[model samples]
Target: MELRIGNKFRLGRKIGSGAFGEIYLGTDVQSNEDVAIKFESVKTVHPQLAYESRIYRVLQSGNGIPNMKWYGKFSLKTVLMLADQMINRLEFIHSKSFLHRDIKPDNFLMSKAGKSDFGLARKYRDSSSYRHIPYRENKSLTGTPAYASLNTHLGIEQSRRDDVESLGYILMYFLKGSLPWKGLKAGNKKQKYDKISEKKVSTSIETLCEGHPIEFATYIHYCRSLRFDDKPDYAYLKRLFRDLFIREGFQFDFVFDWTVLKLPAITMPKPSTLCKCTLLILSTF
Candidate 1:
């Protein structure tokens, strides 16, 4: 099925779907460029799509973030490059006084370009306010069970540290393809989450990163050590990955794991092409 949005986008085949909405591969009719279009029902759900659109608007000027090509939009090239770019994105989010409560592989949509789902994001406080947001317990689990921080499992209110810690898990998952708690079993969803949370708190970083890069362990340790109110040194975290890349003799090219597969060749747009923002002109359905 095909649906046209305004004069700019022509939605094509469905690419993805989730609890929030469906994603389609779209085309910019004017520019003839490929884009991803997400459609969510406003009747059945909260306005998460609109909220994510606002976040993209705030991030339009930031580096390493997916460009807001149109409303409710944004991929990375390599795993290292992806990690580096995401850290910068998180840094920008924190700078704006928000905590990305959900950080997982699914939320991080990777392609030639990158964008994040901010459905679970919440503002901790005003950016200008220096007062610390008190940590509270008995809060509901907010992020994916596998990638969530131990603090998240313990019912502690999340902060910037939690986001960084979740990123550490995501990076490890990318490298290893599976986490230690991937197959833990329980009678129900709550019990399964509890088991996964227990494993996260109990498992040593060394064991988690065993036979893999040591930098992964180090990154996780640093993120876990941060205090609830402490601001993360994004530069320090980025440097860890940079040093790892140097040691491995890899360049920050656009080539990724998927690029190695027998798939259609990707023709990357010029840097200038990305700078051209397409203003949103939504259609009345």
Candidate 2:
């Protein structure tokens, strides 16, 4: 029951641990650069974690999610830092096609100082979490309870929106630093979630989402969007984020697609990639 940390592949410090395994701050022996090590001890059926990691690869291509390139044989973390760094990564994850089922403070880790990779995250980025359509369509719900959705709590079929609902709770926690709904009591499961549902997301968002309406509204609307058979439209959400910035007179570069930089303004003469992603959702099961 011991881990080999000082192998030839230089290890730095321990950062985090959980039910399945641990994560670490390691330095690639060949390149001598910082990397993350995620070890899976036993078969945990971790579709979400693996799925998230896969999705992170897509986001990493665009520079959206946190960058941890290495998934070695064994690992765990040696440190943690300000929670805000976690939020930044979370925000980037939400921007993609997939929903993050787990967004608690514990799952996030600050990259090495000045190693932020938003630039890589923003590149032609879209949701990579949608890759699970085949798996969850049959009802393989997974996530923590405190941050789970009403449907998820009841063991109903899992959907992308469920991830959004969880994100809403995460945003609330990000803003409030704690969940008020977690402390309350209820008669049954629905009643308990209804209590969480009734909580004002904006009140929490006003403080936590970096004072950005776009981010907060997406988080809140995302909760409402999770309550049905169909998923929310990413393009519409992208548009809404843009409009909110203009109407509210809020100034921030983080305003969803509003930061769209035209590569060439060339006429596609056909549907765009965003259009394809949207179509992919509407047409998918």
Candidate 3:
């Protein structure tokens, strides 16, 4: 269905969706430029568009942050460019005292190099007291199980460390077609989570990042080494990939692999070797 928002932006076909809303390819009537429109229902169990709108306001001036002209809306070695942009984006988010609890491939938009899907975002520090949220345990798992941090799987409260760690997994996923924990069998959901956690715990950084650049492993190691309340070295992480991009003699022309045709296929691990887990169900706040 074609709809116009306030007669300013014309919503076209839906290009993406999430648990809370749908996104459409839109065109700005004034500029005639293409844009994306995010729509949320009034009756959603957990309304987050308003909250996300607030986040967009807070992040409006930050680097790599998505532009939000109205309340409704929300790269690569392309790979290096994307990674660098995301770290810069996350760094700005952490600076604002909010934790983007959900970090996954789907939440990131490739065309704009911006972060989206803020439904699980939470304040890690009290606004008045400025005190960090106390570390806790036995918490329900948050975010996608596949990209979640090891500590997250163990039920530890997530902080900046968790977000950075999840990014490490994302980087590796981009480099390699899949993660090692892709294909494990279990009788039930509980058992499946246990297996995933175990695989993450048992898989060494070196093994996990084998055949890839050492910087990837180093990034993961640094993230895992942080204390629950420690501030992540965002600069260092970004530098890790930036340096790799430089060493590989890649130019910052902004042209990505996907933009080119006749590229070699990415080798994915056999189905029997890697596993994909289902998303963890979220509870309403």
Q: Estimate each model's TM-score.
A: 0.64, 0.35, 0.65
Model 3 residue 94 distance off true place after TM-score fit, in angstroms: 1.0
- The clash count for each model shown is 2, 18, 6
Ranking by lDDT: 3, 1, 2
What tens-digit string does per-residue lDDT give for candidate 3 at 195-253?
88899889999998886668888999999999999999898898898888787666765
Which regions of candidate 2 deviate over 4 angstroms?
Answer: 1-100, 108-141, 183-222, 226-229, 241-285
Report the lDDT tens digits of candidate 1 across residue range 1-285.
111343245545557766565566666666777776664543324546667768777876666655555551111124566677778878888887888898865555443333356788888776676566888999999978888899999999999999999998876665554577866779999999999988987889998877666777888999999999999999999998888767656657645432432234744433321211112222222
Shift of residue 22 alpha carbon in model 1, Å = 18
Candidates 2 and 3 compared by TM-score, better number: 3
What TM-score does candidate 1 reach? 0.64
Q: In order, what is each prediction's RMSD in angstroms? A: 13.3, 18.3, 14.1
> Which residue runs of candidate 3 sit more than 4 Å off their true CA positions?
1-76, 261-285
- Lowest summed lDDT across 10 adjacent residues in model 3 is found at 276-285
What range of 10 consecutive residues in model 1 has the weakest lDDT sum? 272-281
lDDT of 2 by residue, 35-124 (tens): 655533323434235554566657654533465343212100111012123333444454554345643423433232211222222212
